[model samples]
Target: MTSAIGEPNAIAITFFLVFIVLSLGITVWASRKTRTAEHFYTAGKSVTAFQNGLALAGDYMSAASFLGIAGLVALSGFDGLIYSIGWLVGWPIVMFLIAEPLRNLGRYTFADVLAARLRQTPIRIAAAIGSLAVIAFYLIAQMVGAGNLIRLLFGLPYEAAVVIVGAVMLAYVLFGGMIATTWVQIIKAVLLLGGATLLALMVLSRFDFNPLALFAQASDMYGASVLSPGRQVSDPIDAVSLGLALMLGTAGLPHILMRFYTVPDARTARTSVGYATAFIGFFYLLTFVLGFGAMVLIGRDAITGIDAGGNMAAPLLAEAVGGTPFLGFISAVAFATILAVVAGLTLSGAATLSHDLWVSVVRGAKADQREQLVVARAATVLLAAVSILLGIAFKGQNVAYMVGLAFAIAASANFPALVLSIFWKRLTTAGAQSSMIVGTVSALLLIYLSPTIQVDILHNSGAWFPLRNPGIVSIPLSFVVAIGVSLLWPVASEARRFAELERQLHLGVESADELT
Candidate 1:
């Protein structure tokens, strides 16, 4: 069956091109001011709390949240809400535990935080590996989503779609750096929120602005079971594992963590998260209405007929209620969503490569601002090319598993090392390094053995691993390893270093000038 959107749609093309042009304009304007390493990496720490807040919302709310959740809820009813709740709950974890200290202690990348109290070279390497892994997996998901989405919406070939996205994303990050990326995210967020609000309002108007009435109508068509938990999450243990990954992963995501540096200080960082939480939570609520609206207005048969994954439900609903123009608008919004996210991911990856690996490791942290900026741009180009290739290579595969794997890795590897470094003064260099390595390796190994890859992807009859996501085991195991290793291998001098770092985290660093 061919998708309804699997043809050349002129309206969709126009909307998408307009977005690309506008973003490029912003990148050009930003490039002029992107002179120093700080400007290139953290927008010179010049962005206001409100702007960073919108950018944070744009970074966190991906195409998955916009189209995936709406489709999931449209298809699976109450069970679909699980994904939304899992993602939303993670923000509080970020707000309370991560945002301030991260803003205060780090200059550009999250590795700076870990390097504060631990051995610089080894800690940076470990942290860089974890950051790159998360970025790679997350980038794959965004790239694949972009290729497939653009193919369906604009009738572009999959390869061409990916290259286009990569090229534009490179232009944003490679030249304009964080400044351009942040504004791109801010614009996309506003468009997305506005589009979703309009879509939800149109959906609710059909039932006189009553969500329950829409639910009743959907239940009448699909039966009462649609109003209850369904097959979206059948396994109790797998559900818990997935929940753990989603809850903890947000605090560890490099792109999300990188946003804190774009703000001025720790207090503004907290404000950004608060605003981000409000925006994200409200958007998810609108997503609920959009889901039920699709179920009732468009019907399951129609949605599934267009796209078997039900991903077309939101776009189809837009077309059904508001005709082709609105569908074009929503489709363009979805594409913009992918572009915004990948830009942030690409920037994070570049930071790990340039700031952490090149400047800090190879150059012994002696590289000047000019050389560092050059390496950063070069790294951005490299990552962009890699992303385009990966998207084209994984064209028809089920890359959904990669998204979950990314979250699991973030939870296991990055989150453990970060929390321990910040709070546990006794945590030795060996303990931190071991925890990150073990966490990263264990999560990857378990997922490879799990039913997700073994039976589902590889078509094996049975599997050694029981759960789909590794978070249930990997997260706790990481913490245990960190604590146990710290106890056994005590480092006296490291404890004193933590005292100094803790003071800086509590007070403030003042500016990027004070970082070095």
Candidate 2:
């Protein structure tokens, strides 16, 4: 399955170009409809629940889910299922606790929800910081996936592949905004799910259409240990930490939270989550089969020889089952997956900068629609550049592993503040700010000291942080700080507004002006 030395794959290249051209066409069409800040950030709040569900699923089932998790399963066996389970469980938390309230209270970003009942200035600043950090880390994982995928499939240099992805993503967000990004995600989602389903069925047909038989074959080939838990999460503490990050982090993802605003009302927001959870859960099931299929059909030696991180397993598996044209289709789907997810991330980051920071803070919510739109586009370009550099800098890391770091930050920083703001009264602006700042800083600092960085990347002999993920410690610390600060420094005004916030949360926003 190895590509020739520095030679482009003609089939893959043709498929990739076709996808690019089609996506750009969609973007051009969307740009014509994108004139207002509402349109730019939330697609005019006009997306139906079904379309938004597909879009949300598209955003969640990213390169990390499609390529990284499949590769992890191929490499680590049963331990890789942990990532899938962790991510899937978080949707219920979003559906029940966050999604409806988020849509009703906030207009553009999560900070809007927080600022609904609290002081705007400090809250927006802290939230923007937390959000941008999460987006940055998540963006790195996606960009890394894109770089490796393009390099392997198209024979481009890794840096060049990264640049191409960044440039294209920038165009989507800069012009078409959420309208374009949403449709791109929808298209990518359908293609990815179909490609994965087809690939999984092809593998299962060889094993009598019974998934257990595929697992059995994998067990026989790699030994029974491959069907059981292995060393990837050998330490109890690390297992708990990673679990907390993956499960809770999904509720905190800025781009995901932003999706609720694209839908019309609170009820639609909840419905969309229901649809998304179903799609995502099914997709994850297919990945389990796809992973084992790769291990049994392609063998570990061939899989690892192609890419040490095992990121190429799914595409390689596609080729094994269906040959070169199938490989081209699956590879293009992977590229589309990367592009759509990064576009969503970039748009969310732009919203935080333009709506939360620029319009709300810098101008004291005085900026016109035109100015806000300009700032958002400018921020998109900035984030795209930063993401491109980050992708090149962290060239060879396993993207799934990189995403875990992002989840840790999200769980620690964004999740706690958001929950406290919506569910806990007596949460002062000071309390929310402190929680976000502490959660973000502690998670990042611990990550730097963890083995993933101190040893793996820095070449140090030992890591100061014992666990690979800081979620076990950082998540609780964030909650504790938030509770302590609220209890000790209560704000009567914020507490009073909780009653009004509650009314809006359940009853929905009454006026059109409220949404704007």
Candidate 3:
């Protein structure tokens, strides 16, 4: 059954095989020094700013960004540009506001920042749950995307593709930990950017090196009447919801924030973010070319017949221009992208579970470094299994939609707490906990009842919820809840402790030996 799917080109298979081997080798080498919990969780605080920056890019540019944005632009024109813009704009907020502060306060996870001066148990447990939810949804989306891409490119059975991805990603996290994961991300980022650049050049060369000619050609191909700025958006509210989810959502992601902890200090963290922003912005601009290339070169009818979910736009374009070789290379790159992303998600989830939940909550601040490392590895395996099951369950769904939901949830539950904790002096732990709970619950409830899920998944004629994403509503609700609660219970002692921690985090002073 696995072999019955179309066979990938021999060159493509070889390239993919080599990537897998290289990634695994890096993981094995990284594991040599994984002797302490700090090493397993934070790479022993040894990762440089530039390397961490690349890793952050690798983590941020998931299959959703690489494939989904291209597909969206191919299908929805100007509406797709909205997604690209939203995603790209969020980084400035992350860099200027969140990055250095998060790095200064956090050692392992986002929870470390939020739970820093708070009572350990409740806040840690809540944060762990939020992190796990965000990671699981993200991992499943990537795994499902991997399976679908393998099926499309190699003609492999879905289960076989998923199992293969699961195995490789598990090996990445289990053996390599943060060090291996970072290097794998850097390698994947380089390959992804290189591939996009080559494809973009090929696409531009088709228009005889004229940028205006490319857009003009795309408009003509799409028909001049539908090429207007707002033509693709059928519903204004849905468009706004989508934008809010992509923009705010990027700032809130746990895996992305965790990358800051890998670097040495606040200055390095800021520099890393600047590099990431420039790289990501450039790649998104390239996506516009690729999307329009598909529209003109491949045509909508051909692409729809070839790809049900539209993820095939970029790969199909590769095949059309460069034939079997480019197709194979693109396929291999897509596979690598999925593997790197899932590994990062698994590692983030594991850290939240082990460091935040088990070590902080269950062990009651008494567990040694060795004991914590063991817990983290165990949690990694458990999260991997959970993600595999989810991948299988949501097999044929659009990967972009699932990823969007994860982003929405992350933005709602985590973003407010993180922002307020750093900037607002009166933010109590109770406020933080309430914000997480409210944001998470509201977003999940809204999503479950949304038209996309309620009507589409449940086969209902009417939707209980109107919005496809809850970020616009739920994110604000979380902020309000946190502020309201904090105002009511603004204790002076907690405020003083929080202020001191903020000063320490901003100053980069190391006080607690227990902290990494």
Which numbered prediction scores highest in lDDT against the true structure? 2
lDDT score, candidate 1: 0.90
Local accuracy of candidate 3 as per-residue lDDT tens digits, 140-189: 89989998888877878888889888888899898889988999999999
Tens-digit per-residue lDDT, 196-254, candidate 1: 99999998888998989998998899999988877867889888999999999999999
**How many steric overlaps does candidate 1 have?**
0
TM-score of each: 0.98, 0.98, 0.96
**What are the C-alpha RMSDs, in order, of all predicted structures?**
1.4, 1.3, 2.4
Rank order (by lDDT, best first)? 2, 1, 3
Cα-lDDT of candidate 3:
0.83
Per-model CA lDDT versus the true structure:
0.90, 0.91, 0.83
TM-score computed on alpha carbons, candidate 3: 0.96
Pairs of colliding residues, candidate 2: none
